[model samples]
Target: MAHTKASNTPSPRTIIPTPVNSTADFAAQQRNMSADNASQGSGVKLKKEIGLLDGVAIIVGVIVGAGIFVSPKGVLLYSGSIGQSLIVWILCGILSMVGALCYAELGTMIPKSGGDYAYINVAFGPLPAFLYLWVALLVIIPTGNAITALTFAQYLLQPFWPSCDAPVEAVQLLAAALTSLLTVINCYNVRWVTRVTDVFTGTKIFALLVIVAVGIWYLCAGHTDHWNEPMRGTFTAPGLIALAFYNGLFSYAGWNYLNFVTEELKDPYRNLPRAICISMPVVTLIYVITNVAYFTVLTPEEILSSDAVAVTFGDKMLGFMSWLMPFFVACSTFGSLNGSIFASSRLFFVGARNGHLPAAISLINVHCLTPVPSLIFLCVITLILLFIKDVYTLINYVSYVEALFTTLSVSGLLWLRHTQPKTERPIRVSLALPIIFLITCLFLVISSVFQSPIEVGIGTAIIISGIPVYYLTIHRPVEWLRNLSQSFNLWCSKFFICMPNQEKFD
Candidate 1:
């Protein structure tokens, strides 16, 4: 086991030290790592157990979750037509691919675990990075988990409530309970989590592929009625289109999830881009065709009326096996929620390691080698958010904040291109790609203000609220406050059976 270095203040960050052995960094003076063998510069000791396939499973599992099973309804509603919704799905996939490629450069170059927070910290500095962390840890991460959990609970409860909506209290309680269960599982074992991810990834993909096959067969059996007016009712307003994208892009949210655990991925330089290449196109295709499948079997009114589209599709198509659809969808969402919890905890852990969050959150369990404290904190917040009733509203808040920070991240990437011209980039993307993605994403963030002013304003306030938190928490603390923080850290260490993360034990 590694001995943790105790500190009251956050670590200084001219560079985050990633140790090769006991004490020496992978690089003498650097935050950026190069090539397949190099580890991320996160300093905290986490294993590289994730292979290329595991990486693919992680991205696919997380992205293809409740969104695909759930978001088509929102896409169809906001897009105002089956045709427009399909276009949004395709465009969102392309947009995700572009942004992911930009992140590939950032991941291979910096190879850090915190994702946007790490990239922003290196390119801009801690303040901007901390602000991203603030919105993410509070609003984005928990709400996403809450949404997934709620979706899972809804589907799991569907067999009982075959005709009507599940009770609100029942849904919320089940969601909270499920979130807690996954958190405990995550805190127990890292390898077990990946194994669960791999298995569930296959299950969800199979479920989606089943839908696509059935739809294709239905399409081939001379059922072309739904294609007569594809563009009929498409929304022309930019705000509505962007809102549709919020649903579409929300389904594609986990494309960059692998970057959050860069340190845990084996041969990141080779595996990261390879996983993205293999996973993105496949996920995009499944999403589009699955929506096509939905329209093929069910009318737009039917889709709009149902809460769980996939379940309804199964019910209409699967006959006596209708129960199996809910079962498969339930398993799919369980895996997705698991993946979200896994990746999000790592983000908070890395943030704490950099001193942007509570010092206790940086600690790794001596026995399990997972960041138990961070996982628990994430579970607590997610459970709290599960109390919020509107799942779609959570998705919008997630999308709104998601677009804002991702735009900032690409902006930071461009800044790095100007500032660190000579940095070794194992995977450098074209400058034009990030620029185009940045502009397009910025538009999505702005367009939301016109459509959902209250949500956008609330997102803005959440981000701005981080300013005071940064100043008070990370920047300056009075003597008594510092002492109180020390005592809190001590209690957390003793209770959680953890110590601060170190580069190496020896």
Candidate 2:
């Protein structure tokens, strides 16, 4: 009897599902299963596979783009003092790190894919979440991508045309083409996309590091003429210092890109938090050192007056390598474009999935397991932005709204801390940290409001436009108020009413 145990096992193919429920339900089930199957087929067994290195690469790649190349001049113009400008950079780095820490906690707790959208939705409800998504999709991501792409194209073209005179239309077209090509490459394979990002990010970091080292050596070799200049009167003013700090903060953007891919990051609860913490300090160090080098080799007056500080620095360091600086700048901007495209498409995909955007955009390719529709949508929008005449103006307008939403997102951290105190937290920062972050973000938002009223008006119009579209596409006119009330009530309860029980006291 013991020897009679059966050796036969049913083949996986032989096990077919016995259907139950209406055709619609069955179809829905099949669609989900197919999506799951596609994910499996791509050998993407863990969305959480991204490690510390990938996280660092994303943070650095996003932060070190055209901002550093173009921003130093602005910072110098605003600060008018090398020492004061360096201090502004340091303060900005610290503020960014604080905000990043707050975000790290939220990201780990949610462990979802959408980054700020998910956090805002959970804490503030659908309307705010939708607005955040709308602003990001329509203004921030597209304009940001265009700026980076345009910067890349400009730098690449600079070497060929040493005169630095080129047709604006030609640069715009080239930028658009570059963005579209990168979007296609990313849509094809996630692994290859990551590899390309790694290469570009590495190249930019190496170039910057070399520039820093050369500047140090040159300073040691009697290049101190720029270091002992009298402090400029403009830099002595507090208002100018504030402006430089804001500019420095803008250059340090992308501290939060890693949070967008939480679902794909392995051990997000641990790795995501650690990645942000580690990357912030590393980037801050790089930025500080780079500024010191610039100040050592070139005066504030020189930097404020120069269009290409990095190129000037390179020429000073090694005459021959001056030709190579533009290539490095191109690589830096390209990496930033790639990172922005990668992170931002996920926001669209999540919005579409949640019925906040057009459902068609939620489509996932069965073979590649990528959100092809969202990717294409992003590409088209970026192309449109490329036609806009001024990248700086676009960035300013988009950043104002982005800073507003970011302020909202940071407020969500405080709201969640009070409301969901009993909920398990994967990462925890000190209470003071969030308070500092909220204050910093609120300051930035207020500053933005005062700095560019017209741009803020345009950004508000873009957000309000979404409400009508939402009603037409998803909600009935009669029930619109009812749904809105329900959403408001939910936000209040989750963010205000639902305090933690006694055992979990903060």
Candidate 3:
């Protein structure tokens, strides 16, 4: 790398130490990282600003977004009874914890930023990894962000149209605007993003706390009629139970989000598992109790009929102060969208760095010290997805597809264990835990086809579509596509004032 002889130039930003090699023992890796942390201002890598608290906040913020606030009614709707819905919620939390535990081992063992992509790439190989990335880039992460933004818009606008649903156009327009704004904020600085996450996580928790308190008061005041026959309408079909879990698990989706930025996290060995340990159970408790609170005021029929469950809960319970529910929901979802965007951009950035994605995606903004191109690319896709007739039309299939990939990821952990038994795990989970979670996730994916065949069919089609893309762009690239990727990569680099990840200032 060369630089002009200009006195005004700032020193080249230092990249932090790369994650320890997966084969190294945990004790040695920790010492290496501590030594690396002692030296600052050296590398071109992302800054390590996400401490343990930040990790917990990111996971909670992302998981507690729109799914909980807007459509948790789906859980009750599919489960067919209060008792069953509550059971599914608890089971979903356990399942997420189990899966997140498996990921902790992967995060510490592999210690890379792309979560499933990194693990699968190491254990399975690049082709399957690319497919996961392809589907995620298309179906999972951005779709989740779009749903969060849409819900944020709906709640923020609901206060304005007290008598009717907010106009779809207004909701979507605001959703796009919010998405764009967050993408810009994310590009500017990592700390700025984490600060927004921490602040909003607090407000969001307070909102849920109020709901739970009010509901508890209602329960204490002898409003037990809704639970008089809690098991009265429980569904017995396996498929229906699986659908209920899907609804419950969507809110639990980001439990593994912290694994996505293992490199950016302050101390992956200590903080990764610690954050998971702290965040998952707390979120599960909040979600389950919060649902219990909702039932205290809203009957089964009301929950099934209402579009915005939290807002409706507010209207029924908060009276004149109902506006606060929508306000806080907007805050919760805005944070969720920011967390998802921050994590997923790093996924693509790492993927590009590893040669699975376009090189331009790996470029770092010289001025912003962030992956500007990936953030912008994600924002553009999210905006396009946001404008579709129903931004969350794919929500029907999104969780199903997510379950499929996570299953694949955990299976990779099992594979790594058998293949490389000597590798030291920083936070080893019980072998039986991954086996149980694996079986459960497999059941969810299989049962989803029976629950909604057409939607699952579309998701399967999307996954299959990636096979050819892998061939054309990666496994064996053709002349034209490779050239196009090169030309586009150069244009992006120049226009963004960016340099490749491995390059540093002189």
Model 1: lowest-lDDT 10 consecutive positions: 22-31
Flag regions of model 1 displaced more than 4 Å.
1-44, 388-395, 504-506
State which candidate has the highest TM-score.
3
The order by descending lDDT is: 3, 1, 2
TM-score of 3: 0.91
lDDT of 3: 0.85
Best by lDDT: 3
- Which structure is stronger by lDDT: 1 or 3? 3
Models, CA RMSD each: 7.2, 8.6, 7.0
TM-score of each: 0.89, 0.85, 0.91
Q: For model 3, how does the per-residue alpha-carbon lDDT over 307-368 read when each residue is reduced to its tens digit?
A: 88888999888989989988998999998999999998989988998888888898887666
Give residue 199's lDDT in candidate 3 (0 to 100): 95
| Model 2 lDDT-worst window of ten | 497-506
The models' CA-based lDDT, in order, is 0.83, 0.74, 0.85
Off by over 4 Å in 3: 1-10, 14-41, 503-506
